[model samples]
Structures are given as C-alpha cells and as structure tokens.
Target: MRQNDAVAANAGPRVIVFIVFDGVTLLDVAGAGEVFAEANRFGADYRIKIASVDGRDVTTSIGIPLGVTDIAASIESADTVLVAGSDNLPTRAIDPALVEAVKAVAGRTRRLGSICTGSFILAQAGLLSGRRATTHWRNVRAFARAFPDITVEPDSIFVRDGDVFTSAGISSGIDLALALVEQDHGTDLVRDVARWLVVYLRRAGGQSQFSSLIEADPPPQSALRAVTEAIAANPGADHSVRSLAARASLSTRQLTRLFRSELGTTPAGYVEMVRIDIARSALDAGRTVTDTAHLAGFGSTETLRRAFVEHLGVSPKAYRDRFRTAIGT
Candidate 1:
C-alpha cells in the first residue's frame, strides 16, 4: 500500500498555537487558523489556540480585533507555534520582551513557523540567522537589506531550513500550514483540509513569487494576463515558446524581452517552472509521476523526471517516499 494509505490508517490529535502581534494581517492569522481548525476533520485531535505578545486583544492591520488567551507561554507548551504576519513594524526593532520570549520558545519548541512579515519577529529573535527563510515578495528587498546574514530565497513560497520554517504573504500561509499537515499527518490529511477549504491541495513551499516570473508593474494590457490564465486553465497544453507568444500577439523576441524585463526570467524558463510547480503539487497530493507530468504539461514521464532531477535534485518517487515516511501520519 502507499504511504498515504498507511498514514490514513493511523492518526491522532495535535496542538497548535498561533501568535498574533499588533497591526498584523488578519488573513495570515485566518489562514493558519483555518488549517489547524480543519485538522479535526481528518480524525486528528487538534486544539488551536490564538495568543498575543501580552495576552491581550490585538488589533489587526484591517482594524479588526481578536482575543488572544495565552502569551508567549503558549509556545512552550504547544506542539507547534506559528507567528503571524505584521504590517509595518521594524523587525529589528521588535520589542525586547517579545524578542526574548520568542527566543525562549524557539529554544524549546519542536516546530516553529512564521507567516509573511512575522518572519521579522523570527529574525529578530535569532531564529533565522543562518537559516534559509522567505517572506512576502514585496518585502524581499527590505528583508534582504535588513538581515544580510540570513540566506533569503525571495522566490520561495516558504523555506524549511532545518527547524525554522518561514512563508510568504497572506494566502501562502495556507500553503505553509498544509505543508505542516503533510509533514505530520501525511498528504492525504492535508488534501482533506484543502478540499474542505476549497483551495489548492499543495503548492510546493518552494514555488516562485508571483512577480518573480511576471510583471513587477502589472501588465498594461490583458493579453499577457489572458495568456497566463490560459496556461493555468490548461497546464497540460503544448505551450512552446513560439506558440505562446503567438497567443499573446507578440513577436518571439518581444515576448522574451517582456518576460525578462517584467518577471526576471525567459518565457521558456517560466513555463518549465510553472510546469514543475504543477507536478510538485500533484505529487504532493499522491499522484504518480507519469500522471502528474501529463497533467503538468510535460509530454512524458522522462521529461518530468529529468526536470525534477535537474531542479529539485530528487526523483519523484524518492520525494514522495521520504516526505511521507517522515511523518508516519
């Protein structure tokens, strides 16, 4: 039987604690909340608690308030601690008390995660000094400039550098949470959560930032947008560079230049990355390599395997086995 089948055959409850700071993005908190809350549906006993720096009601970026029952003390007692994103606080200027508190939690927690700008908190607490980390694409330049000592992969949706995990913007928090679910309870449990939430099952934590591939300034005309939509709608289509350019009504050279100028990559490269992203997602959801590649726009399994080897440094089967075997969900 498959690893997912084995995981589903045995599962249990887990504790999750989310920390919310002043002026935090509500969506970041909500995404984490939804994921942990959804764990109960998969036969996992889950208790999610929302907390604050001072155990007070915190105001969100959008001006909403939420009650936080526990302080950073929750982190010490929980199985996982997720730090939610904040709006405009200077990360390095994080409150000294909060910093020490987070550092204390990191020292003892089994799993630690940060969403969006909450990464600043992690960085401030020295949880991500030499660790691979990521945050909102919009904050990449500032984050890099702020913490030159940290290795920041701005393109990743999230980065799991050893024990510390960091994720990009709001919705991507769901992706991070789902990734954690896969890590603990297996992909099947995450898929069940995704289905319940009506979202994509698995967008790999390493997929590119939206602007990493296309348009720093949103494309003026809808033609490029249309082409992008088409590709997503039919990821299995044969989208050669020339053919794709034709669809967008641009000459091949113009298309190439536009992609480089706007998205920082060539058209062929973007297409392949997108295809690989699709394959990664399918694989995470337990699809076989041949099926995933076909669904991801590759012509054959060989093409998929080659790309996986070249870029991800692992065979599809190996990735599935290791990722699954780790959790024993």
Candidate 2:
C-alpha cells in the first residue's frame, strides 16, 4: 500500500506525496512523513508516498537507497505535494528534469509546498514567484538572492503564502507537517500527533529572534521605514498605535492596513518586537532583568518576563544566562 498505515474507515485518504531526488536530505522526508503517519493513529487519514524524478530508486543523503512508489510524472493528483530539501540543492543548479517533474505535479495538487531548501525546486519551476516563502536559515540568503522575484522570509520556521507553504531548514518540516495536519483535522488531533512525536505544537518564532512576532522584512517604502526606524532608534518611545499613525502621516486604521500589507505585522506588534530585541541586547550585555526591562521600554520586570516567555519561549534571566556576553558572574 502507498500509505504507511491503513486508511481505516475513511472514504478517501489525503494523498501526501513527497518528491525526492538523489542526495535528498533524509530527515526532510522522514520528519514530516512521520508526523502525518502518526496523525493516522489519532483517526486522521494520510496516504504518504515517495516519488523521484524518474520511477527509479534514488540514493538519499545517507547513501541508502530510497525506493519510490511513483514517478513525479505519474501522480494524477494529491492533497498536498511537498518537495523535500537537500544540502546539495542550494549549492548547485537544480536539475531541469526535477524542475519539470515538480511543474507537472504542481498544478494537480491542492497545495504545493517545499521542505527546507526544497523550495529551490518550486522556485526553479517559477511556482513561487511573487509568493512569500522560507527555506533553511542557512540557505535563506542564497535562496533570496537567486530568486529575486520571490519574497524570502529569512526568519520564519514556515511560511504559507496562499496555498503554497515553505519551511525553514531540516526539522522545521515537522512544524509545517503538523500545521498541515492541524489544517486538515484541527488542533485536537494535531495535538495528539505532536505529543506522540515529542515536539511542540508550535514554536515561538523564526530562526533569528526566537520571537514569535518579528517582522518578515523591513518595509520597502521610505515612509514605512521612517516609522520602523524611529521605533528601533528609541525603543522607549511612546509608540502607541495613534502615535505611530501620526508619525507616518496616516490614520491608525491606514497604518495597520499598511503594516499588514507591506510588512506582515501590526504596528504595535512591530514596536513590541523591537523592544524585545532591545531587551535581549541589554540582557546579553549583562544588565539585570529589571534594568533590561526599562532599557527595552517594557516598564516592568514582570512584563518583560511575560513578553519573553510568550514571544521567545524563555525568561529574561534565562535568556541572559544562556547567551550572556561575559563568561562568568
């Protein structure tokens, strides 16, 4: 059977096809595939299949043969088709044959996605142009530079731009897979799947910040940059929604709409994240959490702790101790 587990009572299973090529990163396939397979035990239905550019078996990154059940050209349709990442992908020209296969199956899938650096294949096929996407943090710079038309979210663990989804390097595919399961089945089933997998249902933020609400990019327009730059310059400034709107010569609603459309964040959210960054810097410099709180515009130690835990999944003191500049107390 194509599925790792029986379909059980379902009328039809969600067909999830993983497209692979030689030297494909092994975890990029197994990490996500395991999530979907485990979801099945919790009453979800996912039919997982492995495919290669050709029907022939291909060698994986670990020098083991991964037998393919289908060729990319043969898939009639799929609930989701994810292109798996590889260490080799970002460094070399994507094989034209692989790109062709992705192009052929992409239109037939309900959602087309990529795991880690597999985004290169989709981008190579011109499927990700004008779409917000992510790849392994290590390759994000190259991915962005090579595919200038695509908006590369450098820090995101995963990005879903419309029906297309892209995830950060390696293990983040598990995060994206859980999200897909959540979308299909809901939080209840996905929670069980995550518990079994021994992974968080959601990580706080992306690669750089460990902050859940960081902005994807600096705004492209000078007007928006003016507002953002002001906040960064003085994290302690009174950056309420009304204040930022006035600074930008816009109304609060207009400011919000612009932030959402242009930067993928709210004005207030941006300000808070900037303050968090400032706080992190202060803590890294060996400032006490209380001192860091005011330095970062948080106003109180309790507030700073709450913000840190909520956004970065850690406390100020904990973050400081773990990443302090000095070696000793």
Q: lDDT of each structure?
A: 0.75, 0.86
Candidate 1 lDDT, 166-255, residue by residue in tens: 998778899888888888878888888989999888654343423333224327674566667777778778677788899989998877
Error of 2 at 280 (Å): 9.0
Candidate 1 backbone collisions, by pair: 13-45
For residue 256, what is the lDDT in candidate 1? 82
In terms of TM-score, the best-performing candidate is: 2
Looking at model 1, which ten-residue stretch has the lowest summed lDDT? 1-10
